[model samples]
Target: MKLLVVFALTLAYASASVLHGFNSLEDDTNVGIIHGHNAAPGQFPYQVQLISPEGLQCGGSLISHRWILTAASCTEHFDNVTVHLGSIRRSAPRVTYIVSKKDIIIHEDFNRYTVSADISLIRIPYVKYSIHIKAVKLPKIKRSYPSYDGCNANITGWGRTSFDSTHEPEILQYAKVGIISIKDCKKKFGKLGKYIWPSLICASIVSAETWEGDTGIPLVELRSSVQIGISSVDSPKPELEYPAIFTRVTSYLKWIKRHTKLPL
Candidate 1:
């Protein structure tokens, strides 16, 4: 029996208006850093910031020189999409890349209501590799990485630090989280468990305040460079600190290979 409470979760969409607010650290002071810490420069080079005229909307990963992996929900509507690369701080120094809507590809099986097949890809022109920007390793198709309890993992994004706060961090932030087995994850939501698609993976977060703008943040396995999941959904009440939902990348290995020319 899923609870009837839904917190006002904000997507990590960073619009030009909100961009100004993120730049103000003073505002962030009171908001409290509920979870996650500042990410080191180039620590997660494959990480990319997805931006629309709306501002910073979602997070994405560079799978190849010309391809980015993100959530289909982020590109639902054809809009001008810009990507920022090689920067830990969104408010300052970095290389930026932009692509057109025609280049965005959402999986054909994508279901908006269920958020199934939530994955999407952005095809950009070939970009030269740099220390701050590189493609992330996808898990081996024949081999599956551990997703058991206490499996090491980390997630990075510029979303709000606290569940109730509207302030997004000016710098990139990352947090270590544990993987929750699907069965255990399902039990957390009771009735809501029915909505949990098998294609999605779940992770345990100390603070579940996932905002709308964090739609496509990458959930990378810490030990190896493998990116295992993409931020997909969260519990209705983020303040309650529920497990975070992600689109399991391993399940779509074939689909990703078919779409992008990654050396998968």
Candidate 2:
């Protein structure tokens, strides 16, 4: 199974490339949620759609009025991004912001090949909080990584609903997933299990699966509504039943605080 890191971006020279080991899917048929449903207006206020200059898309979460947390792979190769927020429909957002490369901060140790240290932060012009636009709570900073095994979580994005389709939904899509231990997740990946590290978290596919463009979306605990992960990479083959991996948010709390300078 090919592990797709998701998102396609065009370089400054106008050459297109997928993140990490990703390859573009051929089909262009429009698809909706995968074993999920359309999110209601303001249901996922923290959710944001990140669009590169060349039109490639990825997902991100608003952690503060001026800060968006996303996958490093989404912004590592590029500096500028168009962020859409406060709307369920991608076409008509309540607010839009353009962030320059100077405000985009990727992890210093980010590795595109191994997809390690896959988290990033993008700062936008400060905006007032509203019902349709709000920050998601993050896990508390601690010396040790927090575990949420078997906990219910939700992921939202406009990514392709299936592996074969390249189409992304116009409306925001969300799915309920269950968190699993890294040990169990490693067993599912088999030979690829070595890449499963403590800094990352895994979630069972359940009836739904994440596809390209879902990268950088938040994985929020259902009980407390606290974000715990950022969408990282996953196998495109659903038949393998590989658990989706995400950059554990708890593991980077200090990094975030240092960069964003926000009090937890």
Candidate 3:
């Protein structure tokens, strides 16, 4: 769980660094979330905050009234975790949700190299206050959709904007890209030959130099506004490529519901 890789130009201060981006994976045919202006600098959706006094646990997602999805390795246990939404940076005074995390579900066969099952979900505190905060909606399980091409999508996070660089973004940033079929991504990424899985739909500029810093942090598609992909992984090489990989949400809809104990 030593997930310390990054991308971008502005290097971290004598230390470390990363934004708009897109990536995907869906059993359904077509879906996408385009990049738009961020909510605001002071907005972390549900008053969520990072658990770190400084740089600690990776952030989590609120899928329901009582759950937050994040990396299992990001926490020591569940209770000590912090949930921040609304504000972009981790230190911004977000409306924090303090509670115990439970019902953890790590991909049964998660492998960093392949990213086959590198996903998980859990419940968090139900918000007690009213504001511009809410959990992102997961896609419905029963609906079938068509796989689309050139579907606009967006992703925002403070992940590394460049290779092995540690300069993470202070304000929440975003970028735009589109979804592509595994067949095409394979043609481009065939050299890596190991990490690509049918479960991932890559989102990246087919040809372009990336801005100084941006990677990971899930390139999400707003399929009718519900989040469907967590940025997974993508790269031709640290110096030569900016291909970002994303986890397919539809592939795991069953797993999500089964683990989170929800009716799909």
Candidate 4:
């Protein structure tokens, strides 16, 4: 299937705000990055834009030549996925691949209600590595949970740039954020804090906020250049000062390796 321009639509939970959504590409209702600057070419070679047949958009990361890592919520209800790669500009990807539903591997224990186990993988044809396209590194395999508190990270996507904006940026946008302790994050979320399990990470934006369409994107730790989280959810009320939530990658390393058969 050919890539089509689509806008943003929110896929929120019962009483909480989520960052994933569906929107028309031609309309300005749900458009660009929230307070983030345009990303430089090849700055995030592993980044990919995922589009559902219904025009729902999310982000993913290339973990191997044939495997993509993303949010389970992004693939849970969408199929015939269209993935754009090797470019910072959404309209000018170096290559685009159409993946079937059978190729998607979502965490079986995923719970949409709590956004738990919210990670998934997509299988695509083997792609050669290039300056514009490369796989991201996963955290080292370990039996214990990894801690990333206070680490600086970079988040990129083509999601809405502002809470009240009606346009999504055609070019990829990114913001720097700092990983915060789950304790602090839970305190900030109040009742929503119950969902902030150990497998989920919380981050506060150092600059721009992450909004709709930014879900499923990668959160790379700046120091190690390793992808540690997947954008999962955020508060709808920009004024609440809630932390952006991510599905912790290290917690699922074995799960990803089992499905992708990669030495992650």
Question: CA lDDT of each candidate?
Answer: 0.69, 0.78, 0.48, 0.77
Q: Name model 1 segments beyond 4 Å from true.
A: 1-34, 143-149, 207-209
Q: Give candidates' CA RMSD values in order.
A: 5.4, 4.9, 8.3, 6.9
Model 2 misplacement above 4 A = 1-30
lDDT (10s digit) by residue, model 2, range 1-264: 014232111111111112212223322344544566889998999999999987888889999989999988788777699999999998999889989999999999876556478889999999778999999999777667559998999988887765566567888988788899999988987777776788889888765657767888889999999999998864534456678778888888899999998896
Kindly indicate the candidate among 1 and 2 with the higher lDDT. Answer: 2
Worst 10 contiguous positions by lDDT, candidate 1: 16-25
Q: Per-residue lDDT tens digits of candidate 3, residues 165-248?
A: 435445554555677777767676555434456776666664211222222234446555456566544342443443555567
Error of 4 at 244 (Å): 0.3
Q: Where does candidate 2 clash, by residue pair?
A: none
For residue 68, model 3's alpha carbon misses the true position, in angstroms, by 2.1
RMSD of 4: 6.9
**Order of the predicted models by lDDT, top scorer first:** 2, 4, 1, 3
lDDT of 4 by residue, 1-264 (tens): 001111012224421125521222222332465556778898899999998887778888999999999888788876578999999999899989999999999899886665578898999999999999999988878767558999899888888865567556888988788899999888986765666688888887545556667778899999999999998864544546677788999888889989988875
For model 1, residues 136-233, the per-residue Cα lDDT tens digits are 88886666655545676877777766544656677887767778888887787676676666788877654322444677878888888689998876
Model 2 residue 81 CA deviation (Å) reads 0.4
Using TM-score as the yardstick, the better of models 1 and 3 is 1
Which window of 10 residues has the lowest lDDT sum in candidate 2?
7-16
By lDDT, the best candidate is 2
